[model samples]
Target: MSTPAVRIADLLEDVPTASNPPAPLPAPDPGEAPRTGGSTLNITVVWGDLTEVAADLHVTGHYQSVVPAAAELALDQAISGGSRLIIKEHTKLGWIDAQLGEVTYFPCKAGPVRSAAVVGMGPMGTLTERRALQMYASLLGEAVALGHVESMATVLIGSGTGNLAVSQAARALVRGFAGVLALLSPPTPPPRLTEVLIVEVDRLRAEQLHLALITAAESLPQLRIAPRLREESGGRLSAPSAAVYALAALARLAGPQSTPTRDGPAGTATRDGMPEGPDRPGREEALRTVLAGFDPDIQGKVREQLAHLATVDRTDLSLAVGGSVGEYDDSAQVRMSVLSGVGGLRWAALTGRATVPERLVPVDMDLLRELVNRLTEPSVEDARELPDLLSRVVVPPDFQRLLTDDARVLLELDRDTASVPWEFLAEIQHADGGRHDPLAIRTQLSRQLRTPYARVMTDALGDAPLRALVIGDPGDPEKGFQLEEARSEALAVAARLKNLGVEVSLFVGAANSREPGVDPARRLDVLRALLSGRHHIVHYCGHSDFDFSGTGRRSGWVFADGLLTAQELALLERPPLIVVANACYSALLGSATGLGRQAQPSGAADRSPWGNPQAALVPSLADEFLRLGVGHYIGAAWRIPDKQAISFAEQFYTYVFEGGPGEPAPTVGGGVRRARKGLYEQYAAGRVPPDIAPNPKRWSSWAAYQHYGDASDVLVRHDSSGTTGGS
Candidate 1:
């Protein structure tokens, strides 16, 4: 399968250009001669017969379901065995079933072109300017893979049957071409493909196309755009130029060339092509860092910190270690970076670290499943071997060196490395026949997202009155899981927040009633509206599900209306400072074997153990919240029991609003740490509620609570006046 294109910035035009020719081609009256053309850095402008242009490959196009006149005669004769063979293939596959925005290659039989491609436009009369440009770009990529080329030629697409204005079409096409070129060659490497010759039918249209090239060249100064316009007879053709002058622009753009323009701050277009920030690393260096098994930013920071730590004598040491492992193609192998302070920081040769073992123990799934089943039960087997298995799988011997009897470490992880249950990493077995808890439980350990160093100092919401929105299940009790426990949990949290002087808005449906309350159907609209303001916190208690059938897994919350997917949530420009999703598997991400399936309408209590075999394996809402830029996110990775969740929430809020032991106004992580400790304390005391029996499994539930942002960022603060304050 082809790699998906990196996200394209929204269409833009205000890019700074290197000096272009003295004057832009004069604009043409509709259907007049082509406009004038200009030159830039690397991209050259020229107009001539496309059939006669010297290039590696030639590209043409046809509508998704319709073959226009331009592609009928000449294109048919250019391909091997003529157009009849192509027609037969299309007829057998059916037009609608054929791939869109793709190129079908045909070796040149009796033409100057070495190879030719017919790109598919969606449909006649239905193509938008954006679609046309995007398809053209994609076609170029396909042609490169087909011909293995360095140069190419083609006519302007989307201008003929699509009836696009010359100027607008040219701009779109040029942008598409420039975008591809940027992808192929950044600062790190020069492109393999060198030049693209665009042949226009008329001087007027060619000039318009050249003008667009000039604009693109200026905006993408990194690209060496040296544009020039010419006539069919090889004479210097000057005048107004049109943007829609070449079909091969995409293919040409795909050649190695870095276009340094980026969408500026706040999604605005910058006129200059230079990247933002003084510390921006070179493109090649960044790519190399990624290939070296870590995020470029994190790798740089880790390298610096490691060097410093080697000289420090501090007992508490944080670590960010990474190495190459696994297959190059798999993300799990590609991103092997792990940021951990749990049990302190280990000293290892950073270049070649151990990888997570494919399997930790010699056992069948049944045995593993049994072990999982017994985790919450009091009579659980002495699974001190759990940590041993984990250590072998992920932790290297050097990791143990960093450990102390009492180490408070924060473990940061890339998305792939985050999948491991680090909370269960510990040596339960000792020479004295005593078992140890996971390093996390033994130490003040927390998991955080691995972000750039610059963002680490970002403070939490200083908005006074700590605004909060609490939402609960709106699904029908009979059709969906009965969220009675969820509703009660929401109510309790809201009450606690309100009592603490927090501005809390509660949205929960009445128990067992299908009444309208925070309708899930309108989740997108509601979220857009709610997230628009500068709220300090957002909390939700509900069911969530994931779809894993597609290339990319999608996750959403179960609502009365529908599953509110993560894609919809991404629409918010400003997310709350802290998001506490008190839902099952809220701190997880979708995985192939995890919660990749839809939610089954089981009427289990809110705190029922997330018994689904796949539940523990997926990414949760907490991850999504963090990705969306929620300053602090708290979530549970497993099905948390109602009492435990409520207790944790109450304890967390108390820590944030009121002084706890030493911390007067605790950060979100601090609150979470306190709540988890409280749960652990309760578990150790065998203080299981009357309904549930005392078991080790009950204590293990605390491990599910996860925080995925800066640990030092306090959600709220309080002054000596005993009033809650914002921080």
Candidate 2:
């Protein structure tokens, strides 16, 4: 196969044979090979530009709207038909076709490469090395099945865009190749792919990557490995293109593998996202024990909230969002479990599909991320298409029927689904000619942060007038833009609390001479001291971090000195009743894997003494609060504007604390609900401030706020009246 500009055979024939061959493959020790006969895969690491690598297939990784310039430049020059501009245009337009991990292959017009495949890796914030490996393995399997790849090359997917270290990146690549080898086993003559070239940019890093691959190869005994370097640059490898390769070695380590069957036991469940093992212990006994330790009156109120949640006579459902790059499809798979006592402990696991549109593909996933992104931020022309977009997330028919009864369904969504604004979903069209948001009619929503400990909070919240640790503008002042509205927002909230007979400890940006030692330079120390006091609420009004550079499940406020991660939050002896992290991406969940990229508990095995601990399976700032034994948490699920956040918080606190003359104080969930409603009403009535109101669509930020815990819980005044309010 040859392109118009160059012949494939000639390109392969041009390179000379290596003077020294790579190390021979090692055989498994006796009794190490599995009795289940299956072939292995061969993997190799070489240092060179992807364009220069002589292989049948090329794999290129790309961020949402970004293409590697150097790689594109090489393709442009090698191809006869396109200019630099044309190649760039194609690259940009091509992304619309893939959400993530969907490979699009383009034939080379010039260069030595025969064909190039682009694998979309959504964004740096969400792309984990594990996910990269899965997608890469799937792509490899596809290429081999097509019977077209004799050899292939793949760029270090997340190394550049995702800020992954060379060793971490190489390890994922090696495992991905190994998985393909393991999966494509048997007497069926193996894939023609006999060589894999792991390509990187710089030689020093490449040498490091080679060492990592060699380390990985110790377990894989099917192929020899070698390192190839550029001859002209004194053993250095540099080319104006992305490098790619395939694994020739595969591993079939003989070991006992536990395969849990779908119908194995009453507590056992398939990988279909169903709840297993008679509910987490934290959900029942642990929580009950914690509640028992609370003061009598506070304990009574806390139990009342729990009882209210338990009053649901209808089905209880848990929705877990999952995705995979299937051998064919590229979309999300929604797994659900319905538990109902009405039918005597009946439970069922449901599977549903949600598709991604080609246009306006998801670049950054926040919540029902792929599904929600389509509806939340639409172009002007697509505004009228909102209802159609919402309809794409079709609830399974049986699930819909479950919602029809007045039992008040309890919907417990995992962090991913929690990010989606289910309140705005249009399940059906109305007679009035518009669809109603499903949340308006049915389902009581709350996030299942996976840890439950109501007892620890009841005592601290005992009849206390909400004492708040209010912080504004935690971002670095000298280097970062000022959050002008944050100070005002904090002051307004403090004033409101005071008016409602609550104690407020407000910390604005270092301008306050009244409070000594409370400057931006000692942000963390100041916060630790303040939190040491008896406070029921901690409201942060500033920027929050989404990127995690070092180890652990850590993300926090961007203080002037450094990041205020969950580790510091762990220092709090008594957790607050509620925490309001009002910042952009403050509520985003961490990795879905058991080890999250957010915060780890103090005593967890993964906790690193010197660095941030590996994030627990549920890694969100909100989750951190829950882990700290906080009762309730409210945070923005995605980026929010200053005015919207301020207005929402103001209204939310007002409803929670000082209610209108006739109305009773709103419950935590009720307060949040009304806040969203009030914000939406303000938008409709043209009452929102001009700076943020011109675009009605911006009001969607109201829907982005998420609650993580018992929504019925309320903050109570320490006064004899014991009035319950928002924290």
Best-fitting candidate, measured by TM-score?
1
True-vs-predicted CA distance for residue 428, candidate 2, Å: 2.1
> Measured by TM-score, how close is model 1 to the native structure?
0.44
Candidate 1 lDDT over residue span 630-691, tens digit each: 66667666666678888889988887666454433455555776778677766667677643
TM-scores for all candidates: the values are 0.44, 0.43
| Candidate 2's TM-score | 0.43
Candidate 2 Cα misplacement greater than 4 A, ranges: 1-369, 375-394, 401-410, 430-432, 437-444, 451-464, 510-522, 586-619, 660-665, 686-688, 694-697, 720-727
RMSD of each: 23.2, 26.4
Instruction: Determine the backbone clash count of candidate 1.
Output: 61
